[model samples]
Target: MAQRADISVTWERWQATPDGQTARLFHLTNRRGTRLTVSDWGATLTSFKLAMPNDNLRQLVLGCDTLEDYLQSPYLGATVGRYANRIRGAKFSVDGQQYKLIANEGENCLHGGEIGFAHQLWDAEIIESIPAVRFTLHSPDGDEGFPGNAIVTVTYTLSEDNNIRIDYEATVDKACPFNLTNHSYFNLDGVAGDVGNHVAQINANQYLPVDSESLPDGSPVSVEQTAFDFRTAKAFNQDWRKIVSDQRYRGFDHCFILDQNDGSQPVAQVRSGDEQVVLSLYTTSPAVQLYTGQYLEGTRGHNELVYQNRDGFCLETQYMPDQPNSDCAEECIVRPERPFKHSTTFAFHC
Candidate 1:
C-alpha cells in the first residue's frame, strides 16, 4: 500500500488466468475512506465500499470471492464490449459486407459473443497522479468475427469527492459497432436481497420495449403511465407485480433512452432502501439499461452469500441494444475517422 496526501493505492496478486498469466487486484481509496477494488483479469470491479455515517464500510456492489467465482458470474462488475448488449441474428452488415458473429445468446451475439472483453485479461497500469488504474486490451481484426484491429482502454478513477469515474476509449482500424459499459450490480442497502424498496428516478421519457427474447421489439415508446415510468422517485417495486405477472418478463430489463448526453447533470439517481446512501449516475451515453438481476437465483457471491433473484440491479450505460441491426447502426460504428470515447460516473453520498 502506498499513500500520497489523502488518496492511496494498494494491490495484491489475485489469481492466474487460464493461460497461466497472473492477475492482480488493485485497490484505490479516496479521501473520504471510500474503497474500490479492481482486477487485471477482465478489468473487473470486485468491490466498492462506501464510507457510511456510522463508521462502518458498506459494500455497494455485488462481487465474487475469487477469479474462478467471477468466471461463473454474469458480467459482475466487468467491462463488457466489443459491443455491449445484443446484436440480433448474430449478424450485421458493415460497408455492404455481411458479418456473422459468434452466437452466445439464442441466435444473437451477446456482449461481443462467447469470449468477450469481460473474459480477457487486460494490461493494468497504476496512475498515481489521479489515483487511478487503467486497463488496456488489444483486439485483432476478425477477433470474435468482428472486423477491426482495435485498442481499448478502461480507466477507473476514484476522486476525492467520492466519485468513481469510468472513462472508455477505443480506436479501430476498421469500422465496427462499438459500445461498452460496466455491468455493476448495485444494492444501496449493501446486502444480498431484492432492490424493490430502493427509491429510484430516471431522466428518460421513453424506453425501448423488448420481445420474448428480451430484444428490442419496436421503436422507442413513451413511458407515460406505464410500469417503465421512473420520471419521479419511487420504489423500484412499486409496479413489481405487474412485471412478474407477465412470464415473458420478470422485472425491469429494458433500456431507457436518456434525455441528455452532456454528462454535466445526473441522468438517474437511487436512494438505498434504508435511506442511508444515495447514488447519482452521470453518463455521456445515449441509453441506460436497467436490469433487475431476475436470473441471479442460486448464484453465490462475496462473503459466501447465496444470491436470489433481484439481489442487485445494474444500470448499464451505453448505446441502445441491437443497434447494429437497427436503422441507427451507423451512429454506433467506430471508424478510424471516428474513434469511440465515452464516460460514466457513479457519485456516492451519505
Candidate 2:
C-alpha cells in the first residue's frame, strides 16, 4: 500500500483582538514540505508556502505580518459570505418583503454588507481524520439586515497531492440570499512582479457585461473576438493595453459564466510566467469573478511589500452578482429545507 504523507497540524496563539477574543493560527505541513497557515479570526489563509524548483519555498498568496494589516482590508485571504458579491441598490425583495441591507460599497451592498463573515470570529476545530480545520459561525437574526439566523461552517483541507480543498455548508431559519467564496489574491511568482505575463484559460464562452457601476447590466455576452476571450490558454496581457485605454473600467472585474457550472472538473487554469507553477480552480458555483486588483493601493503585505494594481489577481468562485435584481433571482434563495452547500478546490503544481 502507498504510505500516507507525513502530515501534521500545529495550533498556536497568534494574538488577542481588541474585543478580548483570542485569535490563533493552525499550521499544517506535509512530508513534501508544503505548508499552510490559517488564522481563526476569519478562517483566513494567512500564507500558502509551496515548494518550488531549486529547493525554494514561495508564498503564493498575499498576506501581512500583523493583525493590524488584516484589519485594513478584511477581504484579503478571508472567506466572504451571506452573499459573496453585490446586491444592487442595497435592497432586495424576498417573499414580497423589501429588505434593506448595509450599503458598505457606495449605494450597493458588497460582499454581505459591512460586517460580512470575513470579519467575524469563528470557532475552529482540527479534524485529525481528514487533516482539515473546520470553522463555524452563528449569525443572529437581523444581522446586517439579513433575514435568517444562519449557521455556517467552512472546512479547509490540505491533501498530500498538493490540493487545497474548501467545503462550505450553511442553513438558515428563513429564506434568504446566501453565497460564499474565498477571496485569495494569488501571485504565483511570489509577488516578484505584476501578473502581466501570467497565462490563463477559463472554460467560459461568455462573460457578464457590467455597467459603469461594475454590476452586471444584463445577460452574459459572447467572448468571441473580444478582449474577454480566454476559452483557450493565452497570455492575459496580450490585449491589456486596449482595455486600460478605455475610461469606463480599468482592469478585469468581470464574471465569467462557466461552461459547466458543476464541480465535476476544473473550470479555469492559470500558470506563472516561467511556467514553473500552475494553479487550477474547480468550483460548483455558476460563475467566477476575475478581479485584477485594480484598486489595490496603500496596503502593505508580506515582507513589507507594497501592493499595487495588478500585483495579484483573484478568481472568486461563487453565484452571479445582483441575482435578486437579475432574471435568475430564484437561484439565490436559501431556505431551511434547502441549505447552502458548495465546494471549491485550488490545486497547485510546482
Looking at candidate 1, the ten consecutive residues that score lowest on lDDT are 240-249
Per-candidate Cα lDDT values, in order, are 0.91, 0.86
Q: After superposition, which runs of candidate 2 have C-alpha atoms over 4 Å from their true positions?
A: 1-5, 244-249
lDDT of 2 at 316: 94
Tens digit of per-residue lDDT, candidate 1, span 1-350: 44467788889998988889998999998778889999988889889999987878999999999788888899999999999999899899998999999999989999988999999999999987777999999999998999979999999998887899999999999999999999999999995788889999999999999987788999999999999999988998898668556643367888999999799999999999999999999999999999988888877799899888888999999999999889999989999999999999999999
Show model 1 residue runs off by greater than 4 Å: 1-4, 244-249
Alpha-carbon TM-score of each model against the true structure = 0.97, 0.96
Count of backbone clashes, every candidate in sequence? 0, 0
Q: List the RMSD of every prediction in angstroms.
A: 1.7, 2.2
